[model samples]
Target: MKLARDTWLIFQRQFLLLIRNPIWIFVGVFQPVMYLLLFAPLLKPALNAPTQAEAYRIFVPGLLVLLAIFGGLFQGFGLIAELRAGVIERSRVTPVSRLALLLGRSLRDVVSLIAQAIIITLLALAFGLTVFIGDLLLAYLMLALIALMTSAVSYGIALRVKSEDALAPLMNTIAQPVLLLSGILLPLTFAPSWLRHVADWNPFSWAVDGTRALFAGDLGNDRVWQGLTIVAVLTAAAVWWAAREFARSVR
Candidate 1:
């Protein structure tokens, strides 16, 4: 109960900052929207869907995963900025649970990612994509889990390096390969056998594949459960690690 209350308070503070500066939300969603507009049209030859809408069914899920992966990873930039401004230093003196402090920010990120997802979903609809409500909700759930996992890990990275200059290169290096291995732009069935084996080892690949099943309206599929399970376990492990790092940093 105490941890929940502390987390809520910290979430409220971070959410207020989001409400005050709505442009940050827009900027965060812009790149994905651009892909929806520009790049989605170019997938015609590669997508085997019967219609443009069906093609979107396959494409949008990948974009959503792409958004969650990159957006969650980049969240630590804000933390680094706050740390440099002495905001985190001030918080260290507070009686709040260190876990709550890290989790509160992660909660804020989850909300932000969901909001962007809604925008992306709406745009996809406008472009004639059809999605079942239940599957859509599940996709959002996946996004939340991915956001939780990535943001927590990103926070740990930020605390350790504490420098945007170093973090940028490190994140780019890690994120790019993860993105490629995850195969968010297309299914890994297109990959050669050995490469497909390599991609199977990526946790994010499970997630992307699960999302593709969801968007395809296969709610009962094994892929969905497999992806959800992996994401849930990874999220728990990441939160544990981030909380530990936060506890140490506060001391």
Candidate 2:
């Protein structure tokens, strides 16, 4: 009960800060919109799908996952800024629970991801993407879980590194490999056999595949369940690990 109350109050504070700066949403929304408008049409000829809408099924899911990755991965920048501003250091002296601090900020990240995702979805629809509402909602749920896990890990990294100069290169190095392995822009089904084998080991590929399935209206696909289960477990572990780190820092 106490945790929930503290988290809610902290979330309100974080959310208001986000509301006052709406440009972040626009920045996140732009790349996905570009892909939907410009890049997707290029893939339509090669999609092998029967219709333009079918091609969108393949492209839009990847754009959604890509948005989640870029949005969630850089979340630590805000924490680092707060640290330098002595905001986090000040919070350490407050009565707030350390876990609440992480959860509150992470909730703000999820909200941002959701709003960007909705804009992307609407724009995709305008570009001929067809979707089932329930499945689309499920895809967004997957994204939120992914964001939660990534945001927690980002916060942990920010606390450890504490320098944007070092952190930027480190995250970029990590993100490129994950994006390549996950096949975010294109499905790996047509990849070389060896490359497909490599993608199989990337847990994110499952999320991509699951979301692709959802986008195709295949709600009962096993990949969808596997993706959900993987992200849920990862989110729980990340939260625990991040909360522990934050608590140790406060101490």
Candidate 3:
């Protein structure tokens, strides 16, 4: 009960902060829209084959996952900035539960990412894309999983890096390569043989594949189960790592 109460307080604080600075939310929505509108069309000609359409549909889920990942990853900036300003330290000295502090912040990102995913889905629909209700629900669940994984990943980075200024370059460097290697913009089929193998090993690819399966509506139960298993394992590992990092930071 204490943890729950503290988490609620943390949620309130985080939500208020978001309300005060709405630009972050706007940018989150805008970036994905731009990508879908600009990049999707530009690449449409090259990706027009039947296999490519299937691949492209599969890619949409990955893009949604990316939206959540980007939102959660960048949220670490808020934590780093607060720590630098001594705000986090001040909160730490209070009766606030440390776990609540971390969980609440992470939950905020998850919720925000869900909202962003909805926006992206709506935009895709506007573009004449069709997604079944069941498939959409599955995709949303995948987005939630991605957000949780990303939050944990970001928390680990935030705890280790110690400074917001030091985080920017590292975040960019890591995020770009992960997205590219995950086959977000290109299907693994078209990737060079070596790169195709690499994409198979990527956790992000599993997410994309799973989400694509959900959207495609004909995914086998076993394939869906496999994808879920992979994402669950990754999310669990990330959470464990973040917990250890958070403990170290508190000490």
lDDT of each: 0.91, 0.90, 0.76
Candidate 1 per-residue lDDT over residues 120-185, each given as its tens digit: 999999999988999999999999999999999999999999999989998899898899998788
lDDT of 2 at 171: 83
**Any runs in candidate 2 off by more than 4 Å, and if so which?**
none
Per-residue lDDT of candidate 2, residues 28-82 (tens digit) = 8998898888888878678777788888889889888988987888999999999
Model 1 stretches with alpha carbons more than 4 Å out: none
**lDDT score for residue 30 of model 1:** 96
Candidate 1, residue 16: the lDDT equals 100
* Candidate 3 residue-wise lDDT, 200-240, digit = tens: 77777777777777788855755466767888888888877
Worst 10 residues of 3 by lDDT: 49-58
In angstroms, give how far residue 232 of model 1 lies from its true place: 0.6
Model 1 lDDT vs. the true structure? Answer: 0.91
